[model samples]
Target: MQNVSSQQHFILNGFAELGDLRPVLFVPFLLMFIVALLANSLLVYVVVSQRSLHQPMSILIAGMACVDLCLPVFFVPNMLLSFLFDWKGISLIGCLVQMHFIHFFGAFQSTFLVWMALDRYFAICTPLHYQELMALQRFLKFIVPLVVRNMLLISLFVSLAGKLSFCRNVMNHCFCEHMALVELACGSTAINNLVGLLTVFLIPVFDFLFIAASYILIISTMLRSSSTSVKALHTCITHAMVITVSLAVALIALLSYRIKNELPAAVRVFFSTMYLLFPSCFNPIIYGVRTTEIRQHMLTTLTHWKRLADPEALDQDGLSVLRSGKSSAKALHTCFTHIIVMVISLTFVLTAFLSYRMNSLPNAGRLFVSIMYMFLPSCINPIIYGVRTTEIRQSILKVLFTYW
Candidate 1:
């Protein structure tokens, strides 16, 4: 027999445990992929387009958004297509590629977290020297090591992994990863394990220590400089939230990978899938909500969208009795009743049609889609409160027209 089992292609049996539900799984996963891609893409465009948003903090955010955007584009769409068609086969070289990027992007995110912390520290603790300390040339020089070091570390890990022989040609999860591939080895995995530990220590562990130290110094400076304490805390709290959420997910992912074989297959699949999706999905949202500049850009962009969506949504609304600074029971009765009846009729007819269209889908699938329609306040709070009478619409149009 050819000894190709250890040298040839492998299979990625993504959520096959779901059986019929596997088809249903495609929608949510794809939806998450699309949303994360668009959200982060728009975030990057907003940061780069809006000139006033160009700052150290905004640049770091845009960098992170770029990472978040690329992270998903590399993995999710392929997984979705694979699941939808049940093509689990992955060539050996393809597996190597996937494994390399998964770790590379992860390490990039950790390095970025540390960079953001340093930016925060300089901004809050050493405000006067911040500009000199963070000059663009100096900052880019500093980042060279961060980018090169991680690439080399993950590259060494992937090269070391390529030495292993794999008799098992099937991955029992949704994605390709170092540890998952390591366990399929036909030879001693001692070297693989050592390299894995080294990679972990060099990337996550080292960056985490620096992150801890940065925060400790930030807090101490905040306390010692009592007058700026409240303002600094207010500014730093959002970064803190983003850091905590990111590290928590990373920790959980590490734990899950370690015990993946021990966990039930379904649990393993879900954790594997979600570990990739969650960071890509949430980081842009956190930054968009928490960062002042990003919030303003998003608000202005959405206001333009609203104006385009409904020209009369502003001062020229047809429903003028409510805006005339005078309201009577008769005006209310006439307008409110007609509008309510028409809306109810449209909503009923459309909902019934939608329900019929979705009748072939399972209850769980239908419920999932329905729940997603329930809008969250965190997603829209900026638009609701950031109304302005400035000529933002024209500016937006000009920028778009110029860029396009």
Candidate 2:
């Protein structure tokens, strides 16, 4: 009886330990993940489906979109399962796989963003050579190796990380992160941590330095041009906004992990946002604000979509509300209304589903959060830039008219 009771007690304690904080972690992450998937997917559509956006800059944007797209896919599903099913962790082999893809995609994101900055800097600042320098073939060549390099770099870290043995099953964060897990290992992790640090920081350092140098050259060149180049400045401003947001997040994540020992939980959480959230949320907005073509197309698409859904409605102009060119205010109002409707619809459905699964809500919510976070960019991005950008709208319009 004593032996049996002791074994039972040990099992119960293990269950209790895993249950402490994981259940409550679901909803927030789910909401964010959903937003990311929606946004990034829209970005991909706009970049690939619309021919006008086929420039080198947009091509690089497409690459970033691809990375963002893959990120949530890998992260959200695994995270959701772990959180919801009381399966709060990954096996050693499972963790190696997760880390490999996550780091590869993350590195790819950073590299692509830097590539975009260089593309813009050259186009805006070195106009004379821009065409010859980043020709289609060259752009293709430039990207292939960059992608391969990022994958290899990440692979190196993942292999090194895999070699380290974990004596403790405690993972503080939701995912199979490189440094966080390595820190928990009972084995000597100094080499692993050092390699992880280099993998995260060194490339970013080089990318940042290159971006900064490119911008400086761009600024110097722009200043020397005529006042008529105001449009160019506006373009730079948009690019700068995105570059700043992305670089800032990357820098913080790198710095935070480097000082992971010194930082608080809140700080780590903030760094996590840099990785999983900021890129999806802000990238579209930046493109919408700066790229007139994309913005116009998005607005046009939204208007048309609204009209198509409510074909019976007519505006004051006695025009089919769908086909009528809307004033800026009406367009803005429609956009807001669309967003509210979407949020409410999702909330309603999710709420009902959660209520039905009350006992498993926390784990479900956590899983949902992870999936949603990855999925977030996919859907929202379409509304923000795809529906708003006129050029994309026209392209779609052309296709519709031609085919239908």
Candidate 3:
């Protein structure tokens, strides 16, 4: 209640600077957010259900994937809601709540990357001892505390900032961040700034160095071998790739807090958003696809969906040819085009009939929906042929790429 009674609520200028263009940008951003959620969820499902993926490596990947899933839920939904109706008012308590979870999950993800890198290091360096060292029980013991410690430490900075009265309340970022609030304070912000920088160095900065060390040791160990297997080398390379992106994007975001004033507002916003968004979207795509076991399971699932979509597909194994017609996959795709055209024609006819008989709509509006159907090729054929097998069009999508 102290916050509500004293601290002022801030305006989250989330794309409001776009003026009229805010509405136009809403749909694409919403679509991207939804895709990230679904992709992460699918990763979790594949890891949990596939027995072959129960190893320590898959377990850690799934843990990171679960965090990536929750990280977006904290910010994206609110941003979507704000975009839809131009809501920028966030209560002091509300902003603090948002800031806490963002830091908590963001730090946890970086911490997980460090562990995953170490997992590879041990597996390669001490193959005999790796099993005892990275057993699932001992592994959880190492990670759970890291997450809890980070959450409590970040909470301290937010608590201190909450006490200082805010003379300014307009936060320019789409979401509430520690630095954004620190800059808005009325009193001394030296401690807040110091804590923020030190926290960045302590968490992601430390994680990056640890990851680099592990990989350096792994690479050095690999180079000493007489015959370094291609598969083992490939796995190490992919680990480096994930760690590089996760740290680089995170550093850009953390460093931007200090230099945010120098950059354009949009660029600052992009950097801040990408810090979490890239990890949420990229981890599932890279780790999920590169794991051979996960890739095979995903392919099997895709093949099943293909069969379900076309029950008449010639051979279930290959979908090689359609029935007796010797139709290739290209021909099967053409068949889907015909089905879509027919369904759309059916919808227009129903709408026209209902609107015409009711006669409630104005004359001009009715003509477009009702009168236009009579002139189209789809209506002409179905009405004349009346569902005969011999009357289907050879190519129902002739006008797909044309202006018509």
Candidate 4:
């Protein structure tokens, strides 16, 4: 009641000054955003233009790619620019708009992820219904309402946000989030808080629950099949890993926002890394490791590229090269790459932990590392998944050939 009374008049405390480590934060996120845009655009091209990928799984992946493509574009560039220019000043109206889109996009992403879970569940558990139910037209019809509803809800909430006068605008995170913004509001924000709780907490939590339930059913159904337990387990493992990572990020973000005083800039940046960057960066790698079809396709594409690079090399020397202990060489290369990736990931994770534990490292370091870590998945996705996959390669080639 007292807070509400005082909320009628409020002045923002602007932390618009450049942080000490601004340069370290700017380059990687900019690069990552560029790569993510290109990779996801190519992914979209492969999924949509390729008739071979008109199937359910591919369609769902296309949706996911679209979401991934939008994620960095919407948030990262503005953040990089803000940090680089040392202009953390956000207009009240502009802040509201950003908050709206962030919520809409983030919510849409969670919704689509649930759809993916359902897609896999159907593919695994109810193969009979997959074709009929997951048809492109039918899926669009199902998705249209979700898109419309989210837009409406986000708009409504943002309008409410504009009403709340800001007591402070110095955000902990790079971007303006609903919870963070709301905390700055001088108004009681009881209604806005309720809406935030609903949008951020209720909606995603329910979707997560649904996705979890679908996976549980899928696992049960797979277990009963008894045809290939290993295959089922592999699929389950990949799904579980992504869900775990995403949920962990979401939980941490919620905690940081809710417990405002305790959380630092570095902690907020860490959450941003997990929530925004990790999924885009590591998704392709995770899919590549888990899905044999994707791996085989990638290998075929790589081999084709190698052949194309040296057309005449394939005849005598190429045959010899193919025959000359290819398996052992490939096995060695795979082992080395795996070891390197594992070591790098472990090292980076440890560094983050140490930075957090010893409050010595600045927020900029955390942001820079987060950006780099997130950059890999999005940047590598096109080369690792699309160019490497035979189906996508063939489709891309076919399109290029036709255009030429």
Best by lDDT: 3
Worst 10 residues of 4 by lDDT: 9-18
Residue 168's C-alpha lDDT in candidate 2?
56
Computed on alpha carbons, the lDDT of every model, listed in order, comes to 0.68, 0.60, 0.70, 0.62
Q: Model 1, residue 311: displacement in angstroms?
A: 3.4
Q: RMSD in angstroms, all models?
A: 12.3, 11.8, 16.3, 10.4
Residue 244 displacement in candidate 4 (angstroms): 1.5
| lDDT of candidate 4 over 1-404, digit per residue (tens) | 33443233222222222246555667766765776676566556655765766677666666777777777766676677665775556666666666676667677667876777877776778778888778878677767876776787688778887777666646666776777777777747788767766666655677778878987898677656655334555555556656665776777776666554455556565575557765665554454323444344444444566678985666774455344454533543344346435544654676566666566457776666566566755654464345434467556545644564
Better of 1 and 2 by TM-score: 1
| Candidate 2: segments with Cα more than 4 A from true spot | 1-25, 80-86, 227-229, 307-404
Q: How do the residues 191-266 of candidate 1 rate in per-residue lDDT, one tens digit apiece?
A: 7777777777677778878877888888778766656655455455555555654565565555555543344445
Which regions of candidate 1 are displaced past 4 Å? 1-5, 255-261, 309-404
Q: What TM-score does structure 4 among the candidates reach? A: 0.71
The candidate with the higher TM-score, 2 or 4, is 4
lDDT of 2: 0.60
Candidate 2 local Cα displacement, residue 25, angstroms: 5.0
- Give per-candidate clash totals: 1, 45, 0, 3
